[model samples]
Target: MMLYYIYDGTFEGLLTAIYDAYYERENPELIVAMDNFTDNFLIQRRYIDTDEKKATKVHNGIINKISEDALTNIMYAYLSEHENAGKYILEYLRFGFKVGRLVDSYLSDDRVHNIHKLARKVSRERHLLLGIIRFRLLSNNIYYAPIDTQYNTACLLGDHFAARMADQIFVIHDVKRNYGVFYDKSKWFISDIDTKGNLDLHEKELFYQELWKKYFESTTIKDRLNPKLQSHFMPKRYWKYLVEMK
Candidate 1:
C-alpha cells in the first residue's frame, strides 16, 4: 500500500508529519500539502494537522542527531515549497539517522547535494527580500509593505525586519499568501490579513508610491528594453506588490 502523508504547509507541520511517519513505521510514497490534494481512490492517504509539542520534540531530536547547520538546511528546504522537498527531507533524515552525527559529510553525496542546492536558492531569495523590500510610511505612523514572493517566505522575511525596524511599527504583507507580519517597537506577531479588502493607505503613502512608479519608468531605457530579460530578473508574479511596478 502506498501511504500518503498530507500536512498543512508549515515547517512545523512538515516536521510533525515526518515524526508521525517515522513512529508509524510507514514509508510514505508521497508527502504533500493539504491544499494540493486531489482525491484518488487508489491511494491510501492521511492528513495530519501540526502538533507544536510533537514538532518541537522532533526538531530537538534532529538538532541532537545532526549539527545545527543540518537542521537549518532542512528547514530552509522545507520553506522553499519546491517540488521534491518532502522526498529530499526524507532522504536527509534517513542519512542523519544512520550516521547520527556525521550526516554533514553526506553533502558530498549527490542526493544530499541536490537538496542543499535547492535550500540555498530559497534561503538567498528570503535574504534578498529582507534588504530589497521597501516600506511606505502611512499617516497613522504605521509602515506598510506589500510583497509577492515566489516562495512562501513572509515568515522568513519577518525576522530581519523585526530586528532592524525595532523602533517603528510596520507590517509586511505577502499578498500571494494572504499573510503578513505586524511589528511594534515592543513585540512582533504574524497574522493573516485579507488583501482583497480595503488597503489602508494615506495620501503621503500614495504620493510616495506614485514617485516610485515614476522613478521605475524613468530609469528604464526603452531602447534596451527586453521584457523577457526583465521578467527573468524580477518575475512578473512579484510585480503586483511592487510599489514601482504599480
Candidate 2:
C-alpha cells in the first residue's frame, strides 16, 4: 500500500513533512499540501504540523549537505504553487541529498528539470516586476503599490524592493493574497493587509499620475503601434497596476 504524507499549506509544514519522511525511512507516494489532499482508503495518510525545529533541520540539511542553490530552487518551486508541488519538492530534495551539488546538472531527469523550470518561471516574474512595479504616495506619506500575481511572488518581490528603496517607507501589497510588505526605512516585514476598499491617494500623487499618463500618451506614435510586440514584452495582465493604463 502506498503511504501519503499530508501537511498544512505552508513552506515550514512542507519541510517538516520532508523531515518526517526521511526519519521514518518511508518514501511516500505523495507529499500533499492539505489544501490539495484527498482521502483514499487504499492509501495511508499522516498529517504533519508546521514545526520550526523540524523545518530548520531540513533546511540546514539542504544547505549543508546539498547546496545553497538547491535550497533556492526548492523555495522557488514552493512559490510556484503548481499541482503536486509538495510532492515534487520532496522528490527533488531526496535526489539532491544523494547527489550533493551535482543534482542540478541532471537536466535530463524529469524531476530535476521540473524544479529548474518552475524556479525559472518564478525568477522571470520577479525580474519583470522589479522593472514594472509602480509606487504611489498615500495620504499618510507611505508609498503604496498593489500587485496581483498568479504566482505567490510578493514575498520575493518585496525583498528586491526593500534593498533598492531602503530609505523610503513603503508597502508592496499582494492583492491576490491579502498580504503585503511594510517597509519602515530601517527594515521590511510581511503582514496581513486590509484590502477591503480603494486606498486614498495624496493630492500630489494624483497630479503625478496624470503627468505620467500624459507623458506615456505623448511619447507614443499612433502609426507605430505594435500591440502584439508590446504584449510580448508587457503582458496585458500587468497593465492594471501601470499608471499609463489608468
Candidate 3:
C-alpha cells in the first residue's frame, strides 16, 4: 500500500508531517505540498496541517538529538524548493533519529548527501547576494533594494545588511516571492509587498545612477574585457536591477 503525505508547504507544516509519520507509525512513499497533490485511487493520501506544538516537538528533538548544523541544513534544504524536498527531509530525519548527530557524517548515504548538497547551494547563493545587492535611495530617505532570486534567499540576507547599515532604514524586497524585510534603524521584519506600486525616488537619484554608470564605463578596459569572468561572479539574470547594468 502506498501512503502519501501532503503538507501546507511551510517548514512548520513539513515538521508536523514528520511528527505524524512517527506517532502514526506510517512511512510515506510520497511527501509533497498540498497544492501538488493529485487524485490517485491506489494511494492513501493524508493532509497534514501546521501544528506548532508538533512542529516544536520535532524541532526540539532535532536540536537535542541531532546537531544544530543538522537543523540548519534541514532549513536550507527545505528552502531549496526541490520537487522531492519534503520526502528528502523526512528521510533525513528518520536516519538522524537512529544515529543522532553522526547522521551528518554519513555522507555515503544518499538522503544525507542530498540534504547537504541542497544546503550548500542555498548557502552559496546567500553569500553571493551580499556583494551583488544594490540599494537605491528613495525620496523618503529609506534605502530600497529589489531582488528576484530563483531561491528563497531574501530572508537569509536581513541580519547581514542590518548589522552593516544599523543607523539607516532599508527594504529588501524579493520580487519573485512578493515578500521582503523592512528595517527601520532599530528593528526588521518580513512582510508581503506590492512591487508594482509607485516608488518616490530622491531628486538626485538619477544623478547618482548616471554617475555610477559613468564610473563603471570609465573603469572598464575594453581590451581587457572578460565577459566570462564577469558573468561567473555576477549572473546575467541579476543584471535587471543593477544601476550599472541599466
Query: Candidate 3 residues 1-246, lDDT tens each?
Result: 688998998889999999999888888987787766886889888889889999999999999999898899999988888777778888899899989989989998998998998989889999988988889999989899999887788999999999999999999999887899999999889999987778999999989999989999999999999999999988999898988987
Where does candidate 1 clash, by residue pair?
none
Q: How close is candidate 1 to the true structure, as a TM-score?
A: 0.84
What stretches of model 3 exceed 4 Å from their correct place? 36-43
Over 48-124, each residue of candidate 1 has an lDDT whose tens digit, in order, gives 87999989988898888776877888888877787678767877887787788877677788667867887888887
The CA root-mean-square deviation of candidate 3, after full C-alpha superposition on the true structure, stands at: 1.8
Clashes of each: 0, 0, 0
For each candidate in turn, the TM-score is: 0.84, 0.92, 0.93
Q: Which ten residues in a row have the lowest lDDT in candidate 2?
A: 81-90
lDDT of 2: 0.88
Q: What are the C-alpha RMSDs, in order, of all predicted structures? A: 2.8, 1.9, 1.8
Off by over 4 Å in 1: 108-110, 210-232
How far off is model 2, as Cα RMSD? 1.9
